[model samples]
Target: MTINGDGIDNPYGKVFNQTYPGRVILSESTSRTSFAITVLQSTGMASDKMAPLLQMTLSHMSFALYNGLAGPITIFGPSSENCDEARDPILITDWGHRSAFQEWERELTGNPIRPQMNSILINVIIDHILVGIGQRYHVVRHADPKNETKFPASENGNYWIRTVPAEGCKGSEDGNELDERQGFLRYEPEEKNKPQLGNNFSWWAFGEQPLWLNFSEPTIMLLDEKKEWPGDYVIIPAENRDRWVYLVITAPKTNELGNNRTFISLAHPLHLHGHDFALLAQGNDSSQIDDPDNSVVLKFDNPPRRDVALIPAGGYLIVAFKADNPGSWLFHCHIAWHASSGLALQIMEREEDLRKTMTLEKLQQVNDGCKKWNEWFADTENLWSQNATLFQDDSGV
Candidate 1:
């Protein structure tokens, strides 16, 4: 076996490859505008299972079939935490200190099972999203921009999506420089509407998910006045099969740490399958791009190429790669638990890969899996609508 081919590929250059190493290949252009589902809930009832993230793999398969690609998806958009203030009860940062909140803890003990009843610990989200293909879809959530503060002026930021810490660690990237700007122009909200720069909510997109049928709300625009741009994770179809296409992943943050603690667990390895990407930047230290010290940055050009990128916790990581290869590829947190905890995603690298590897019949199974999964979620959505309440009735109660 080749040094990089251990059937398990660890993007951190640690162990085996982080994904299904020998998947088939093709081109990305033949694929259509596939789905990038963003399922964000307050870290639920402490005992939630990691079973949900499995749906991402299924979604990948489903969308891939729709475009006549392989049996599954290859490049999936990252699933970061939304942490809707309207929904999440306890900000995840307060996990170990339930009693520290005093009055809230007293009230929560008697109330119904609110997601906040057990603080939405980062550990919990990680545990759920990174179960099976955890390594493929590295976790990404929100934190205050490393460069700005929350109060008078606001900067936005991001962190892990699901996958939890190795040994039950909690909170956002702790003890790190709070002034770091991984992404963003720097947050300076002028007033409510008169955003000095951009508003703080661009970190998470609203339509990233499909129409919900259950208790949870579909990704809906909450801001009454300022709504997010309609499509964020868009996949533009390349006109010709001969052209080289690219998928650019910008891990940017703003200045606002609602519940998230720190950045990707201090160089928590991230891995993508089918094809490799050039990591443009990891933990860039620039406060301003013009400065030489910014740890976070945006690349106007391509960086380097690798299948896995180990991004430091509490920093910015950017990746750019071609949709040159195909087949069902996976992307997730290299952390096993985080992958299962809703961080896993898949991609159909390109049409050529599918054309070479997937037969018309096997592709049918991919279609079947997607159908079943969507139907299942439809029921779940309906359930959430009927009985699921994202919030406690009253923080005072």
Candidate 2:
């Protein structure tokens, strides 16, 4: 089918940093309507252990979120994460564990991951539905991951994903051209040969974090159109407006060695430049694929209306939103790097916005300039689908 823009025009380096098994889907949760959120943190494995540590936890959580969200997603951690703050740093559990048994880990793995996590373990299961579109917003944290003992302080604030502002102080009519707005300032890595600055003063130790994600407020909830919800084979919006709509997402797993791609999910608050949506289904989960009623039949004619939908790593999701606003607006993963690596896409009126922003003549000219974009995209996307160096029997990964 027509997947969201990927590869050249939008090459996805990795799905939230893991080797994407496939296009991330926002399906509806079946068992009960709820949000399946998986929150995890890894102590530094060693000095300069950022890469390996992140890899280990991401893969672990991706798989956990994928599986956990099939049911309810519960997490135990410092109080920094809100159980349902919608934009807080971390997620709290539903029930509070007052004892010394790393209650948070218990909520996640049904057991404690550590022996000394004695904070009040909370238990939280999504009690809602999985629905709506999640417009990707960027998050530019206000602090550092290593400095803060809690989240948020650890999380830089939201940084909405936007195009490079017009040049030479353009768009003066819409906005002042000579404006000294540093926020809209764009940086080009290519200028300096696109140097990889991870440890420089300009670069950060745990730098290059996402500056946006899951920040859509007026979200249109996608429901199970077939009347079957979380029980259906996959999650999606309901056919009519008579079923569950809200949904919470979780991450899928990858292997530390098998899938080394970075899948870091930084929550970015979405600040729509144009409009907003009605917040519906908040947090919930879906049914297992094997369930008889867990099948989602989509209706493109009347898709669910939403703007932002969190693409949890572990599980599949489905959401719908009406294309009301008219402009060359951005629709990305909210994670800047994710967007930069190919998770970015655009939703515009083919004729009104797209054409206005890029006239057919100019659009054609641009495409002509890069005629081979689509072709190269396919091959790059399918690179890991089937590795090439293997023998006949071992032809693919």
Top model by TM-score, which number? 1
Residue 118 of model 2 has an lDDT of 14
The TM-scores, one per candidate, come to: 0.32, 0.24
**Tens-digit per-residue lDDT, 29-111, candidate 2:** 22222322223212111111111101112211222222111111222223454333223222221111122112222322322
- How would you encode candidate 1's per-residue C-alpha lDDT over 220-334 as one tens digit per residue? 1111225432231122233234344444333334333322211222334566654445666655332333356643454546565555566543444567555544443445554
Q: What is the C-alpha lDDT of each candidate?
A: 0.32, 0.26
Worst 10 residues of 1 by lDDT: 40-49
- The alpha-carbon lDDT assigned to residue 8 of candidate 2 equals 18
Q: What is the lDDT of residue 290 in candidate 1?
A: 38
Model 1, stretches more than 4 Å misplaced? 1-169, 172-233, 236-270, 278-281, 286-306, 312-324, 327-359, 370-397
